[model samples]
Target chain A: MSFSPLIQQLITSLRCLPGVGPKSAQRMAFHLLERDPDGALALAEALQKSVSEIGHCKLCRTLSETEICDICSATDRDSSVLCILESPIDVLAVEQTGGFNGLYFVLSGHLSPIDGIGPEDLGIDKLLERVQSSDIKELILATNPTVEGEATAHYIAAQVKDLGVKVSRIAHGVPVGGELEFVDGGTLAHALAGRRSLL
Target chain B: MSFSPLIQQLITSLRCLPGVGPKSAQRMAFHLLERDPDGALALAEALQKSVSEIGHCKLCRTLSETEICDICSATDRDSSVLCILESPIDVLAVEQTGGFNGLYFVLSGHLSPIDGIGPEDLGIDKLLERVQSSDIKELILATNPTVEGEATAHYIAAQVKDLGVKVSRIAHGVPVGGELEFVDGGTLAHALAGRRSLL
Candidate 1:
């Protein structure tokens, strides 16, 4: 059945999110009306507020309500040990693990020559500048293990080789709890190549 | 690694949509930032506009931006034939068949005593008033075939029985193109129970 223009528009808007098709969007629209009208209102409010109020952190390029991000402002985080990531979402993934206490540098995007995204497009120049000017001892490249991600990391590592900072790439392999039989060949190869010696 | 408060809140707020779990919400948030920033902004705009502008149609209670819905205002539609449905979404479902040419009355809910929802809660009084005052010749009860939906339809049918108008409930059974093996036993039973002889 065809929806009214208002509902159709709302469903179309919701389909912009990942994995949301026309059916799922319609279901979500109805669910909002049925379960949590307040949540729908809050979502509308947050969309407006976040779209207008949030901006890139001046230092780390991550999303922030203020000039600098929370990590940049936190004195408890190790500024000397910085974890460089591809985007703001990556920062969240790393943060959710609760294993790293270092500060972060978000590139906002990765380099893709085929897509016309180069060093300047990805903010690699700013990263080099931060490395050159800061008192950072180690620069950990935590970009994805994709071909483009690897190329971008290599390019950054090349540029900072002479900057007196220890540049290292994070190990790429199967996940900790993943089974060998279930792991893809490429990931298994990556894990084998990056294998460490027993203590 | 820890997420900034802004990023965390964005992910959490996104999970309000149906079928969106934490992983999907994270993926959606990333996709918005990475691939379709414009689409995300459009969604934000649509959400705000729909919530602020759309309301119930003054006559039928279906969602609409104006006082009367398009179906209600259309000259080609039969105003004397009204399809009583469970919600605005049900109106869309019927319209998709392209067979019905009548106005719609959205109940906004089904009668569910377990949930404390009754005929009064679903605007049965308003429906009675409309049927009594209007030139309606037929009231088509198109609520879902579930137990509560059936009960609600029966209650409405009984209420309007003395008013001298023809009252009919939509047939409940297997879908038009459904396969026998694929269909559940409950649906087959319903189809058999509501069967009609071919003339």
Candidate 2:
């Protein structure tokens, strides 16, 4: 016999997660029901609160509860230099490096014409407006090094080039602590083409 | 800098699901917030409803929203044969096979004294009472083939052998369609030991 209605519903709804399939959904549903009901309740509350309350930052378009994100509104960060990324999670990745102290602009996604995604869909106009209206001197393109990301970066560079803002793309190379022998061909080629002289 | 408080809480809460780590949790959180907020809300409601309403079946102790599970209450199912398992998930596995039409008894866990789990904790007394009070003629032990499961099955068999009920453990051997050369040594031994001759 099939599971009771509520248990079946729980398993079905859990399949909406990115990587969860029927088997994983069943495991997760039973795990929550039998071993950790409190955790299930807490996760439910967290999902409800975050989905209903979180919104995009007005200045950066990053996920935020307030009008402006903490990184954008912080006084210690440099607003003159902006790092443009494909999604809010990328913002966290750059922040974790403890290197960038500048403001950020999240595009939410890259240019994907086949999927009907355009510059307007990703708020490119808003990004251009922010750069033109503010005292920003440099714009860093930190989108993923994929076809769509490269196209999106180039398009944005052309848009802001005439506006007198210095535009730069993040370097593509073999990752630190990685051996050259194991590096992918495309990345190695990019590293060779973009190498700088130590002298 | 860390994510905004709400985003951070959502990521942390998502980690409560099995096999979800920090990276997967973050990806799931952003995926829900950006692309599928409606799915997130639905999942939250399902989790809340299932965790609060689902309880153990009165007869079989499998997870059920009703007092008696469908399998236990069905008139067509055989009451003379029972399958003893370690968890509710096993019931679903057996049902999917469509080979057995008997009731089930869920132990929730096998005996483990070091973890402070014993027969009483697993409701072994209740299992005995049900077998004695009902017309059950045979019991099939379908717990995992681990050490603890073997011990649990043997203990239950000893308890019920004197009550005039036939008791048996599921066989452990090379699975159907699996190559004999690829089978493990332990399973090969079991297969040879349990081999039956065809007259």
Residue-level lDDT tens digits of model 2 in B1-199? 7888999999999999999999999999999999999999999999999988999999889999999988988999899999999999999999999999988999978999899998999989999999999999999999889999999999899899889999989988889999999999999999999998999
| Model 2 per-residue lDDT tens digits across residues A98-168 | 99999999997999999999999999999988987999999999999999999999999989888998999
Q: Which residue ranges in model 1 land beyond 4 Å of their true spot?
A: A1-5, A30-38, B1-12, B26-42, B196-199
Write one digit per residue (lDDT tens) for candidate 1, span A31-141: 775556677777766665666667788888887778988789988988998898998888878888888988889886778878899899888888888888889999999
> Positional deviation of B23 in candidate 2, in angstroms?
1.3
Best by lDDT: 2
Worst 10 residues of 1 chain A by lDDT: A44-53
What candidate 2 gets wrong by more than 4 Å, as runs, is none
Error of 1 at A29 (Å): 4.0
**Can you give the DockQ of every candidate in the order shown?**
0.51, 0.89
Q: Once model 1 is optimally superposed onto the true structure by TM-score, how far is the C-alpha of residue A185 displaced, in angstroms?
A: 1.1
Clashes of each: 4, 0
**What lDDT is obtained when candidate 1 is compared to the true structure?**
0.84
TM per prediction: 0.89, 0.97
